[model samples]
Target: MVRRMFLPFYSKDRGPPRIRMQVMGTKGRRFYKIVAANQRDPRDGKHMEVLGSYVPIPGSSASSVAELRLRFSRVKFWLAANASMSLSISRLLGSAGLIPLPPPLFGWRCRGRYHELLQQQQQQHLLRESELRNFFKLPSPISTQLVERETEKPKKEDVRKIVR
Candidate 1:
């Protein structure tokens, strides 16, 4: 008997099964399609089935709540079939009590360090903005009223100084 080697992404018969929420829709609005697909498949590629859909942004409705539409029976069937979920899908499932909250990520992936870095970057960006504002003798970008007033009233002296 000969053993055949198969690639997980392309191999229909091997490896752990995965189901993911595939992002779709246009620029202003976006949504997701819950799909049973190979992990290696392209974002909009082949899907075995569409379990359901989720609309992150509401479509011109007065209600503020986000919409989540699911074929409950299909979801139950897929869960019984042992399909694993993507991170985002898992979170939704967790909130619905369909599954226990997923395990916490390792220490390195924790938010503290990432947040520190983000804060540092934002401070640097703000510093740059302030520097630019000072150099141009213009109101800081943070205040919309200041920006509007500054734009409406021309700084003739400042313009002359820059030209000189």
Candidate 2:
């Protein structure tokens, strides 16, 4: 079946790459991204690698449903198998004749069924952090001045000579 996959982002010291949704390509047990047909093949589509990210140009765009549908035959085998698609990659699917094209996706939304689970996980993380803080018993972050208060009374000086 189609197991939807998310295209996570990666960043380096020099630059960063955009998110790319990928899935096990039907061609030959390879992982490839749903890319524009106009672009070069990512490879033989054998190994799991990015084909390319779907880039939407500003103002006007180049990719169209027609261009995408032309490549549908290549992807039909996978679609029949119900190969999973990523949330961000829906446009490609629509273009390729799987689902109807919708608005551009800025990010991926995991199977909505897990929203409660995600919330629980976040709450658990917060609780663990609080527990750690309480266990450590660390003082406040701000520094305070230490003042010395003298309370002991001074002894009276002996006026009489010592009887040695």
Candidate 3:
């Protein structure tokens, strides 16, 4: 008789495989392992393979630029394999340029609201300017000229003369 190792077989009904981080390390000092796992599994539970690691806080003596290290080839393979990535993992991958960033919350609705707010601000600014002009009893042309003069940048020749 021959002994053989068999991999755990998960059915489609169990849910799609997921790529996520598994928290490790002690309190205060934290470490994370990027892994390919089953969606039904617990956060730090059994995983199929480790894709890479993320160290949020490196050791004091370490001089490396980035704290995160990933195997891009393996990650790409898993992504192509139809594995769904967790939100946090997706954001990290997106920042690394491996994947497109998720759509902004509320999308076009936010842009429309921002434009409305900008219009309201402009209206308020105009109203305030008109009130200031009335209160100071300044002519429109004079006020406009004064604003232009204040906004104009001094020429290099003028700056040199001032410096001298």
Local accuracy by lDDT, each model: 0.66, 0.43, 0.73
lDDT of 3 by residue, 85-162 (tens): 877788678756699755434764477766764575567667778888889897772233213345788899999999
Q: For model 2, state the Cα shift of residue 34 in Å.
A: 2.0
Q: In each prediction, how many residue pairs overlap at the backbone (N, C-alpha, C within less than 3 A)?
A: 0, 6, 0
**Residue 6's lDDT in candidate 1:** 20
Clashing pairs in 3: none
What TM-score would each prediction reach against the true structure?
0.48, 0.26, 0.52
| lDDT score for residue 152 of model 2 | 77
Model 1 C-alpha lDDT per residue in residues 1-164, reported as the tens digit of each score: 21222232344454444668888998778878888776667778878778878776456642222766677777776676566777778866764557765655568348576666457557766877788788989864755221333356658998898899
Clashes of 2: 6
The digit string of per-residue lDDT tens for model 2 on 26-142 reads 553433345322122232332233344333333454453222212455455444434345454665666554676664333424546366545755666666666666787755432
Ranking by TM-score: 3, 1, 2
Off by over 4 Å in 2: 1-53, 58-70, 102-164
The clash number for model 1 is 0
Winner of 2 and 3 under lDDT: 3
TM-score of 3: 0.52
